[model samples]
Target: MDKIKIRGLEIWAKHGVFPEENVLGQKFVISADLYTNTRSAGKSDDLTQSIHYGEVCQFMKTFMEEHTYQLIETVAEKLAEELLLVFEHLQGIRLEIAKPWAPVGLPLDTVSVEISRFWHRAYLALGSNLGDKEAYLRQGIQGLQDRKDCRVTAVSSFLRTAPYGGVAQDDFLNACLELDTLLTPEELLDVMHEIEQEAGRERLIHWGPRTLDLDIIFYDDIVYDTPELHIPHIDMQNRDFVLNPLAELCPAYRHPLLKKTVEELKNALTEPEEAHAK
Candidate 1:
């Protein structure tokens, strides 16, 4: 990726934990590294083809003046997200917020917070066993694509798969999709649930049957777990119904937890009864 850097740009902002800090604004130094492809601009010698540092500086100036936050950490995070949102071509950003004059009586040049944020690639498994199955799946895909912070990159062919759990109502039409999203894992889950609701999915049983089902199969190289969601989906590797279609789209995708490629998982699927056996 090509580089666009803004180093130590001074600004006056009211940001701190103390009440006085908010009343009396202090000096802040901001720096950012924006990443994007510059090949086109370089080859064509066209300024329009590349990110304009001047414009970015102006935007930063305006943004700083407009917003007030209690912590520099919030400022850094907001700026990183804002930059990525404004610049469609930018892939990632490293942001730093330096406070040279902190209230603490310490002999230090400056105190700063630095963070890096970027877009993530995620694969989602879609299935519907009840109602108009294909309609529900297609609606789910459209909902994901319509989300503000996400883009659906690819969709695989739908296939017939036996019910995952013991309560066999009927086979399901299953497919996989790839997405480029700026949302975190939890945010992605929220969006999935919203899509399911739009599809009128009624959760009567645990994998029993549903109008629509959306599960996160992979999320970049990140591994996350909570009471609500898990990345690299817990049972995806053992199910051919999930691994097969996923492999068709991204054979190189490695499960963060298992550390194995998708193709390997697909090849390792024993038989139809394996899901039940496990």
Candidate 2:
């Protein structure tokens, strides 16, 4: 990634804990590092291929002047989100907000807050076995798309498959969804839980019948294992239901730990074990 740096851009804004500070306002210094691939812009010398720092500065100044917040932390968080949303070409950003004038009587140089934010790609598997399974899956996808922090990039055709956990239940309609999201793995899980709950999902049995089921299959080629969640979904390689749909959308997406593409995994699952021994 190439960098376009904006350094020490000053602004007058009303952001402070004290009422008087808000009334009188103060000066803030903002610095940002915009990350993007500048290869096309560099070769073609096309302004359209690159983000204009001047426009960004004006946007920041107007945004600061228009909004009043008590804490710089809030300003940084909200502003970073706004910038990412507005600038489609930016891959990520490091933003800093500095307040030079302190209310404290004691001498101080400045206080500042800095944060880094970026979009992450993640894969999810959706399943439902209860009433109107297709409707539940569609609802789940819409719920994810509605979030400002999440973007649904692709969805595979739903598959009708029998239950895997030996539970005597109706066959499930399953599918895979790809997303570009700003939420961490845990945050994404929480969003999924909210969607499932909205569809009346219950947790009486492991792999039991449900109104909706959402699982995090992969997150940016990351191999993550935690107490609550597992990336590449534990045992997904052996599940034809998961691998088949995944292969449809991302046949070449490699599993970080297994180092095998989705197409390869799906083929391995269908191949006879005797062939593997030979």
Candidate with top lDDT is 2
lDDT of 1 at 167: 85
Q: What is the C-alpha lDDT of each candidate?
A: 0.87, 0.93
Over the full model, what C-alpha lDDT does candidate 2 score relative to the true structure?
A: 0.93
Clash list (residue pairs), candidate 1: none
Residue lDDT tens for model 1, 156-198 = 9999988876885899999999999988899889989988987
- TM-scores for every candidate against the unseen true structure: 0.81, 0.95
lDDT of 2 by residue, 199-227 (tens): 99999999899999999999997888899
The residue-level lDDT of candidate 1 at 240 comes to: 77
TM-score of 2: 0.95
What's the C-alpha lDDT at position 269 in model 2? 86
